[model samples]
Target: MKGTAILFQADQSVTFIEDIEHSVYEEIKSQCGCEHCNCKIENKIVDFGTVSPVFWHEDEIDWDYGY
Candidate 1:
């Protein structure tokens, strides 16, 4: 089965939490992984109380476990 894919490009100049979170989230979810399945963005949230936002793709995550 085809899995979801994620793509991200960080804007180092961005300082606002909302902008950063939304920018990163949008970039990741916008990734077109497979043409076989109809894709959708599952969840996107920003928690200021935590260090960073949690990220995951619908498919098996490779490269880094906690990037």
Candidate 2:
């Protein structure tokens, strides 16, 4: 619980993450997501936005994230 965490919501937006224990991050990654989540890992439905699946699929919406 001594690291940073980035929580990706189902709405395709980040939660402006806080001090979340690393276990929580690992837990979320181990589950299969529902309809609201447009993510798939290992041919299974997982939470999207964790890795930003929207731009990955080309949803016709322009996603411009410049660093």
Candidate 3:
């Protein structure tokens, strides 16, 4: 399970959103502790919206092994 996290800046407040499949919304919501699943905009309609791309990688690594 790997994805990206995006942050949006608005006039009043800042919002965080992610670009991923709808099926994974639950997992992302839980992790981000976001009140809503989708991005909230005050006015105007946006096509791609104000989403900054973030790269995420999930892999199993041995932490016990010293660097």
Query: Among these predicted structures, which one has the highest lDDT?
Result: 2
Q: Candidate 3's residue-wise lDDT over 3-34, tens digit each?
A: 33343323233433334443343433343433
Segments in model 1 whose C-alpha atoms lie over 4 Å from true places: 1-20, 34-67
Instruction: Estimate candidate 2's alpha-carbon lDDT, on a 0 to 1 scale.
Output: 0.40
- What does the lDDT read for residue 67 in candidate 3? 20
**Candidate 2 vs. true structure, TM-score:** 0.36
**Every model: Cα RMSD to truth:** 12.5, 11.8, 11.3
Please give the CA lDDT of all the candidate structures.
0.33, 0.40, 0.36
Assess the local accuracy of residue 50 in candidate 1 as a C-alpha lDDT between 0 and 100.
17
**Residue 26 C-alpha lDDT in model 2:** 57
Per-residue lDDT tens digits of candidate 1, residues 1-67? 3343333223222112221334454443444232221222336443222112234444444547664
Q: Give the range of the ten consecutive residues with the poorest summed lDDT in model 1.
A: 11-20
Per-model TM against the reference: 0.20, 0.36, 0.20
**Residue-pair clashes per candidate:** 0, 0, 0
Q: Could you tell which candidate, 1 or 2, scores higher by TM-score? A: 2
Candidate 3, 31: how far from true, in Å?
25
